[model samples]
Every structure is written in structure tokens, then in C-alpha cells.
Target: MLNVLVTGGNGQLGCEIREVAPEFADKLRLFFVTRENLNLESESEIETFISANQIQAIVNTAAYTAVDLAEKEPEKARSSNVVIPKLLAKIANRHKIKMLHVSTDFAFDGKSGKPYKEDDLTSPISIYGKTKEEGEREVLKELPKAIILRTSWVYSKYGNNFLKTIRRLGKERPELKIIYDQIGTPTWARDLARVILKMIQTKDLSGFYHYSNEGIASWYDFAKEILDLSNLKTKILPIETSEYPTPATRPTYSVLNKKKIKQTLEIEIPHWKDSLKVCLSELD
Candidate 1:
């Protein structure tokens, strides 16, 4: 059976992948490794672990995702976001194992005024983006067969994401201010996990692909939809990105064009609002 190794097993996306792995059943042997078992920052540890397990395919969901905190901890971010993947790619190449690296839409500067295509030039605005972009390049360079999937605004019922944040804040506070100027698609971690599994099933799938829900919405609209679906009484106020200060600068429009991934993978994507409903339903 094909053995699959997934990193960041405890994270939002990683947990969803673990939950769905059983559905694949006898087709693949799945192993979920948390940070303690597979220290990403330690190349020797990762190499030792992979060599011992004889992992066939690596699904790298590990990343430094704390955007604000990344500004203060650039080295840690680089180690997790850049160095780890570079090491994995080298090891995967040596072992002839397939690698799938998860990336973000933050790789772009958001100056294009339209949805970013796969081949568009990347100009990262934050340290987190820079590190992630570096990870993508390093993986592709080391293992040409590796697949790099860039997603945006990932959330789920499981972890610390925007959906849960809004849910918690909506209940605790009477009003919330979300940015109206920023526009992007909200990708449910569950949905993305399913797509990644499908991609793995296809042996010919490789290269950079953008995976996000079909439609786009501003943060304000997204928050409002979340409130409406949850039947929350919180008032969501729209404000500019400037009104809300964060440690890292974010793209005003980081929507990704999914045409290449859709055609190449022969998969259908759900709309943003539809995914939001499905995710919210699980919270009940």
C-alpha cells in the first residue's frame, strides 16, 4: 500500500486530513505526525524519522501561520516555513517520495487588482509571505515532482482560525469591526483536505496549483455571513484595513485564480458562502 506522511497533525488543516484519511481506507497507509514526533526545525530529526518510516508521500501541512507573531519571530518563521520544507524536499527527492507543500496567497503583493494566476509574479508584503514563498521555491527546486498548493483564508471548526474567532467574539461582544477593503476567498480546511487527498490519488498531479473556494468576499461580508448562519446577535461593522492594525501587512486583494488546478485535477470547488455554511453546521 502507498504510505502517506502528513506533518502538522494537530493543526487545523492537518487534523481535518487525519479525520478524512479513513475514508481512503486500504488505498493508502496514513501516518499523522505532530511536532513532537517530527520536529520540522530539526533536519536531522526529520531525516531520521522519514528514513526509519520509509514514508512514500509527504503531505506538508506544517507552517508558521501566526501572521502577527511571525513579525517578532522571523527566525522561527523561517525555520518552520522555509528551512523545514527545503530539508523535506531534499530528503523526499533522495528517497523518491512525492511531496505536497502547502503555501498561501500572501506570496503576492495584492497590487494586481485582480485574481492572481499561478504564473503571476510573487512579491510578498510580509515576512511570513517571504518565508512561505521561499519554501515553495526550495521544494520545487529540490523535488521537481513536488506539488505546491497555494490557498487563502483557511478556517475550520477545529482550530484557531477566522471562523472560530468570529464565533467567539460574536458571542462575547455586542459589535465587531471587520475590514471591508480586503478581498479574498475563504477556504474551509475540510474542503481543502479533501481536495489534497484527491490530488494524491492522481499520480500525475505535480507543480504549483491554487486551491480556494469559487467566490470571493471581503472580511466584513464574510463576518456578516458567519453571524447570519450562526444566528448570532452581534453587529458586524465594516471598516478599512487601515482601521485595524496588525503586526504584518496584508494584501487588500489576494484572491487566487483556480482555473489551472480545477482543469488539471479534474475537481469541482464549492463556493465560499456554501463552504461557510457547511463549516458552521458542524459547530452546532
Candidate 2:
């Protein structure tokens, strides 16, 4: 059996991986570690764990995901997103193990009129995005074979995401104003988790790739669908991004092109709406 180590065991993608891990139990031996159990920021600790367990592969899901909060805490963001990935890449290279790192679409400036491909130029606008972009660079530099999976607008039943936020607020508020201009696809974390597990098991699979649900939607559109799925009566008013200004500027259009991953893995991607329905059902 292939021994695999999954960091960030408590986050959305990590939690989803845990939920679906039993399906792959026959072929994979998965060990999960969160901040409570493993100090990911500590280099010696990570190195020791990987060596002690003889880990064959690693799925690095840990990240500093607070977008707006990152603006004020750039040091913390760099520590989590940059330094940790760099360290992990170095260790994985030494251990000669496969590594898959999760990244975000915010790596782009969102000025592209078309969907972003794996090779597109990245011009990050915020601290979080910049740090993520830097982290990707570090991983690639340290281990060129490491897989960098970039995704957008991730949500799940386990974490604080747009879907959960809208669901909670839609229940309490009569009306919610959501940004409609900024557009991207909503990715269910469970889908991404499954894809990562599959990728880890497949050998000689490395480099940059993109994955998200097939369809696109703005924040307002996503919120509307969530409220509808939850059977909530809260009215959602569509507003421009300027109307609801945030500390970190979001991409006006950050939809990722999934053609590379689709063709490479031959995996079918569910539409955002369809996956949203399934996720809402799980939440219920």
C-alpha cells in the first residue's frame, strides 16, 4: 500500500478528503495531520514525521486563506503560504516523494477577458494572492516535478466559505446585497479532494493544473443559488463590487480553464449549479 500524508487536515479540502478517504482504503494508506496534531510551520517536525512514517506522497492542503485579513497580516500570510510550501517542497525533494500543493485563482489580477490557463501570466493584487503566487514559485523551484493545483472560489460544508456565509445570513437577514460584477466558478471542496487523491495515486503526474466546476457565476449569482437551494426567502440584491468594497480587491473575472486537467485525467467536471445542489443536500 502507498503511504500518503495529508496536511491541513481540518480545512475544507482536507476535511472532504477525510470524508471520502474510505473509498480508496484498499489502495492507499492515508494519514491526516492538522495544526493541532502537526506543526506544519516547523521544518524539523515535518521532516521528522515524513521520515518516521516513510511517507510515499504528500498532499499539502494547508494555507492562509483569510483574504481581507491577509492585507493587514502580510507576515503571517507569507509564513503560511510561502515559507511552509518552500520547506515542504525541499523536504519532499529530499525524500523523493510526490507532492501536490493547493493554490487559488487569486494568483491572477483578473484582468483577463478569457479564462486563465496554467501557463498564463500571474499578476496578484492582494497580499494573500501575492503570497500564494510566491509559494507556487518556491515549490516549482525546489521541486520541478511537484504538482501545483490551482482552483477558484472553493467551498464546502466544513469551512467558512461563501456558501456557508450566504446560507447563514440568508436565514437571518431580509435582504442581502452581494457583488455581481466579479465572476468566477464555485468549486466544491469535495470534488477537488477526490481529484487530489486520484492525482496522488497516479505516478509521473506533476506541474501546474486548474480545476473548478464547469459553469461560471458571480458572487450574487452564487448567493442566490445557495439561498434558493436552502429554501430561504431572503431577497438578494445584486450590486457592483464597488458597492461592497473589501480590503482585498477580488478578480473581476477569475474563471480557471480546466481543459488541461480534464484532458490529462479524463475526469468529468460537474457544473457549478449541479454540484451546489449536491453540497446543499449534504449540508441539510
- Candidate number with greatest lDDT: 2
Q: Rate the local accuracy (lDDT) of all candidates.
A: 0.91, 0.94
How do the residues 100-213 of candidate 1 rate in per-residue lDDT, one tens digit apiece?
Answer: 999999999999999999899999999999999999999999999999999999998887999999989999999999999999999999989988887777788888899999
Q: Which residues of candidate 1, in runs, are more than 4 Å off?
A: none
TM-score, model 1 to reference: 0.97
Provide the TM-score for each candidate, comma-separated.
0.97, 0.99
Q: After superposition, how far is residue 176 of candidate 2 from its true place, in Å?
A: 0.5
RMSD of 1: 1.2
| Ten contiguous residues minimizing lDDT sum, candidate 1 | 37-46
